[model samples]
Target: MRDLHNRISSPSAARRVTGILAAALLCATALAVPVTAAAATTTGTSDDATPQLANGLALTPPMGFNNWNSTNCRAEFNETMVEGIADIFVNKGLKAAGYQYVNLDDCWALPQRDSDGKLVPDPVRFPHGIKAVAAYVHAKGLKLGIYTSAGTKTCNDAGFPGALGHEYSDAQQFADWGVDYLKYDNCNNQGVDAVQRYTTMRDALAAASKSTGRPIVYSICEWGSNSPWTWASDVGNLWRTTGDISDNWSSMLSIFKQNAPLAPYAGPGHWNDPDMLEVGNGGMTDTEYRSHFSLWSIMAAPLLIGSDLRSATQATYDIIGNRDVIAVDQDSLGKQGTVVSSVDGRWVISKELADGSRAVVLFNETGRPQHIATTASAVGLPGRSAYKLRDLWQHKNYNTAGAVSATVPAHGTVLYRVSADRHWASYPPAVEAGVSEAPLVEAGTPVPLTTTVTNLGRTPAISGSVALGGPQGWRVKATSPTRTAALSTGRKLTTSWTVTAPAGTASGAYDLTLTAAYRSPTGDAARSELATIAYVVVPPPDGTSYVSDLTWMSATNGWGPVEKDTSVGESAAGDGHPITIGGTVYAKGLGAHALSTIEYYAGARCDTFSAQVGVDDEKGANGTVAFQVWADDALVASTGVLTNAEPAQALTADLTRAKTFRLVVTDGGDGGDSDHADWADAKITCAA
Candidate 1:
């Protein structure tokens, strides 16, 4: 289990085949793991099975402290550590914030079972036995959670009983020991189907709880290999939705991106896990940890902290103990939030709480701090009204009209609760801005922009008029739907603008501002609503057009996403060497051995093409990275391998007859370690 956090992505060849087949079939059926014990429950479907028998358990996500995130199967898990965890949880006010259960993950048992074939705590690690630790936790008003594998052996190959053929007996043992939770992991099971193997344990646990009257929350750690979200809801309280997450910003972002799509699968009883919270692990900064907490809260993930509570800092305690953020996770609505929008590396996620308010997170996953802004419509908020927004972290309140905006630090997050402002004067109308074309418009191109002023107020506005403005030297004109328009309640007044930048305008974000005024029913001047929209301007697509600014790849990320950036950082943290040439940023993306697609409509006019590629790590990095060019999906040229320590490599491909080409970046094998890839100064020469 050493560095098992990264092993989630590097599955064995056998797992790869089975994973693809299982994923392709979208299999939801679990094979029945038989139990011979008379008191054990047998096999059944996920939905009407054992969970209903144990109703209303884990009604909200279980808040607890688990050893795996901090110790990683490395802790000397004797009675002392368990008691210490409970003491910390109580003394540190974590229990007040809903963090209960001291969970011991993996490697607590001896090398072999006793003569009776029953699981026993290792005498060396637990001289007083498991019951003593449970008693201590219970004394501190906390619960104890035990760990087991679904396979024949535990993850550490400790030769511990995985409950394979002993589900009934092991469940009975755990219940008798006063365990309140069980983290059932997938380890060396010799190719057992996850659904069936995990299901067998679920049934046994239910039977044990029914017979012994000891309720245990079941957590299946299958690592999302079989799409556990499709069926794990009825089997366990939570299921791992992706590979293990390391205590790094990149790893956290990667897991969050993977788990965002499975939001609908999560609810009151089941959640989509992105592994454990690596808060207070010393692997990331405080800002990053806050972002981690915010993302997890917005996602409604289990807050099973993976940290050394005894040694954690005050900031860590504040982050993990934020009751306001926790309220969103344990919101009665029980809905998980998904990524609503991504702009300039800024991601917006919105979750609806039970009280009808929305928990919104503005996350910046970029190297540089950014002003993350979006229209109410983007977050599915009522676009025609004002929202009384509260900054959950800062404890500040804002009367936001129209567009919601926040300046977030690099790899930081801003968490807010958006509620309807019932009072019209307090929550006034707002103006929203948009453009007809993509952010990147060719230099000198005239783009049509629109701004809508709405009464997000309890009453209507009299003599409403909106004025639009943009940068000087750009000929800008505007027209309102109706000048001096008297807007009715929830009615919108529309305005449009046509603006053009000079031919020599630099290509980047250009802001367009708006000022709207209205009179109150009493004929007095009312406060105005203002907004700003940032639109990107780009030069005409020349022979070697940069892919980063291209509409096809810029805003998106992941499987086929691409970014135009010059930072050599393995991650967006701005690491490595300055590799960009004659520009501020380079086109960067990642691939999982498979090609991350980059479309270049360079056309047939290109006579020569070349690019410099390298792994974006401090030189000699172990992970392999490569760049490939494709003509109509057919490989043209590839810069075979570039390790982090190596200088950027150059590649040239034939495009005499090709009009469209794709740029591909690959992990090059050895998993995605240091696979921070870069296509620095990638350009093409045209027949001038």
Candidate 2:
């Protein structure tokens, strides 16, 4: 169970075999066990037998709280803690807040089951039996969730009286004990396809749940292996999407950020588990905890709190119980957040709500603070309409009448819920200016000059002075912004400068903040898009003719270029193995810098050349390359270079199309390296 959150790259050895053989064998074996259970109502092929049953449990996002983070098998389970936590839920009014399930994680089961092959509760610890404990939990108007595994032993090495061979009987026992939820884990289940194994347990639980007239929620505990998102609907109500999250901001942010891309897979019933909430775990501050809550909500993951409820402080209650923030998580539309933009390790994620509002999060994963400006369009909101924004965490409202931008704090997040409004023209205009390309001084190479700026507003942007600013020592004269003082509305202005790159301005892209701030006709001030200029400073160029691994040539003793050459003749395009040129090469016609058949028959002499080559210029005819044969300065036979842009099939040395000829290449200097006049895999066809 401890590995419950550990990420797995592939299925355990056991799961792979099970995926191959379990379907045909499982039912044959389960039926022979003489277990009376309900048959699957939703019929499908054997591999998908449990789909309907699994879907039934995951029909809605699984909502609840888990107890592993706050207390990790501390041997501290007792009626007092359980009841206290349950009482706290009622007192803090969280049950009505949509936090219902109170699950007891690992370490609750006794060492063995009864003679009838049923899991037995430890009499010393649970004097009233598990049934009575479950009843007490139910009496408090909450459901009970228990933990088990698919192996021969529990995560704690407790005898696995509830797995594999005992699947049916154990399921019946759990139903009889009033269990409402089952967390089928992947721990200790070696050499089995966890997917099918977990599915088997789910089917068993479904059978038992049907028999006892109870609907049990089944959870798959495989940590992101095989990317359960693609198969979660067939597995269980919820699936763990990442490794275990710890009680630290780094661990929490890392896990949350990883889940941002996985939001599309999360919807009603199925959820992405970001491990568990570490709010009251005594490791992070209240602000960090708020961020944790905000990110998880935006990701649309389950809100299974992992902190100790009984000992949680007032601040913990406020962070977790904030209804305004929770509204974003419980959004009826169920769309998860997405990373809209990223820079310098910082990311901006946005989620759309059912009311057509949007939730935006600016997360700075780095150590230092950064000034980040994002438009509504960047977060899926079009500027055709404006919106009123509410900072959910700050509990304040903002007027984003036109375009909105914020200077995000360090290692923090700004969560906003924006609603579209018609009165967008009332707010002041925000002016922004940035570099088209951050000027990079390649110690010797000249930089490409270009600049662009967009209004990004419903209205046009007024003209202003856009300047490039950088730290003192590394500025380039040619890389400076032009001295334009005025720009027309919604139009952009471009200018250029020339500066010599110093010896050491670093070797990577440097930031050049482009500022274009100005005053409106009403004497009010504004700014443009905070543009980024990339200044690439490289060391002196290495002027050697070094060949690249992907380069290919069309001449004798030539290699193919990957970026230019697609394929030779009908040989198709790709990285063909290695072509060795150690003999005289002959060409029948000019090649279009594609894969042409260049041949040296198995045992033919080099002088008797009979190689057929074809060029495929897939992009309609333009600058076609013609083959020219030269024996140190003598022109041999030459065919009118074909300029048709159609792809050519493998050309054989048939007399009608090709005659006995030698030497091959594109005409002229072959258009230099810029013009692809190279050959790949020239081969001579033989009557094999």
Candidate 3:
């Protein structure tokens, strides 16, 4: 049977780099490259420094098996399993399906390198040198790939043949072993500049690639820090856009949505990798795997198999090797997917393929399922003539004569490939144009604002996250989808958030930056420009302003010996008077229940005001504290009091001018229970 093996770099090189850094070193060795000395750009340059296949091998979506998902190093690289996949790729029609690379994940390294500082393969597992293993795999027309890290140690605790400072040596070692692919991971080390760190390894890979005269694919594995999209092309052929992806839907979608904004940088020879696919990992359903493959194809991400393909189910094979979908991803035009619309926890992403065809995905990330629909016009397609739409997963074609609508299951998706009819001339207007902003208010104000996003793209943007920044900590206190939303093109959607300012928050005009990001089903992502608007936080008015005590004044108030449910006093009126709530009373209520309060006031323009109370309960817990405010007269009649629960964790709300405020004993009391409550530090500075 034909065989393939992924080789780690020489041990001596790994040791020097590992010990020198005293930390984990992530590194990689490009496979099958031509050894040549050519100046490569390491800095951010617009010049065409694209990588090309050096050896006879051509870049055809390097496919193969990865060991990280199925089994750890608990078992040596299962030689039988490795050989079995190679056989299947050949005999079971996989090679014809364009599957070529057979790579090993982490954990195949011995504890130490040879005397010459070269990596020693685990003799127990391979018995044969890596060269012999490569021969077996090559005989079957398949290439080999291996793994390493930028840190001192491989993620699987293999030998720490450091690549951080020894990238060139490690690359040379892999070249000597006839290596073909490299997956470089960043796991350990602190304060290391990511760009410089990865750039060093990239340079080494290029050097080794030239030294061995073999073409190798450099796969970078960073947990998507500082935005790989900004520099992925300049660094490595492919870069992981997120942390390790699990074999579940959540992890996959999380990574997918996270990569949405990085789509524009992906193209031939350079790809955005969202980690390996866990298609046959028994974690997600077949439907999920289909969605996974569909979205990845649209994004133009590198297609690397992470699960054991030797024993994969038929369903998994069908989904992973779908030809029609693969064509969209490998389109010669090299057009990757771009986000078009997102809303209510769902997204619409569209890809313009080289065939003059468009692939669109409607994704839902919310808890419940949803239905999304848009006409050809909405997706920026000409409607003069009808077009043929095909469902990639369903393997069926439909004539989208009018609108395109489909029911999306929760955490599910719908993918479509549409081909335009040349006969069509002018059609209905598509999508919407322009962006609008909701009303803006000052920071620190107890107010919430909603922003509506309208789509104007040629296609809908798939699932993505929307972030709005104003003053620091200015977050979406409340939003419809809460986490993320998937919206369709031409659709108008709104997301809301509350405004809260932390203590010592400076007053200044800040830009409200809104960003909607998502990856193409092809794996490329486009992060829209940062939407901006200026808003100011005006300081509180200074004066003897009336305040509220809604914090504790709203609760039932009563003196000692009061029953658990006693109403001692009626809510007092503000009457344009700043009422100071003081004098605490213990509760005789049963169980651990304690005091409660309710208060209302107005005109109090203070941000800081606190009251202290002392409680004496032999068996009761600590006394509780609360801070709040209630609307007064006119405001009260309209909106009423907004009471905050007791047990004030932080002195947040203002109680400077409380209307009718009093503390009632709430806990550590029964008919015979006895306790005392005292209050002090009752003051409010409404003087601005």
TM-score of each: 0.64, 0.56, 0.56
Tens-place lDDT digits, model 3, residues 23-111: 11111011112112231222475457544322323233455667767765757465556666778789877678777878776665676
User: Which regions of candidate 3 deviate over 4 angstroms?
Assistant: 1-43, 46-61, 158-160, 189-192, 422-688
TM-score, candidate 1, is 0.64
Q: Candidate 2: which stretches are off by over 4 Å?
A: 1-51, 54-60, 157-162, 402-404, 423-688
| Cα lDDT tens digits for candidate 2, 121-231 | 666656787788788888889887787777766655444443756777777777899888877665556566656777787778878887898778877766565456567
For model 3, state the Cα shift of residue 379 in Å: 3.6
TM-score: which is higher, 2 or 3?
2
Question: 1-688, model 1: which lDDT tens digit per residue?
Answer: 1244233343332353344234323311111221123322323444455444244677788889888766665545667877888988888899988999899887789868889989989877788888889988999888999998887777663456677888999999999999999988776667777778887888899899989899999988876767787677668888877655666655677667667766767788777777789899876778789999999999999998888887899999999999999999999889888667775678888998888778889898754445577655667666555667677886645455645656565577888887765653543333222233222344578766665666544446778777766677877777546365677654776767677777887645555555667765656665442333334433225555544445432222222123445433323433334444223334442212122445554445565567677665432334466677876446789876667666667788877666556676654532243344666666666553
- List residue ranges in candidate 1 displaced over 4 A: 5-54, 157-159, 376-384, 423-688
Candidate 2 lDDT score relative to the true structure? 0.55
lDDT ranking of the models: 1, 2, 3
Ranking by TM-score: 1, 2, 3
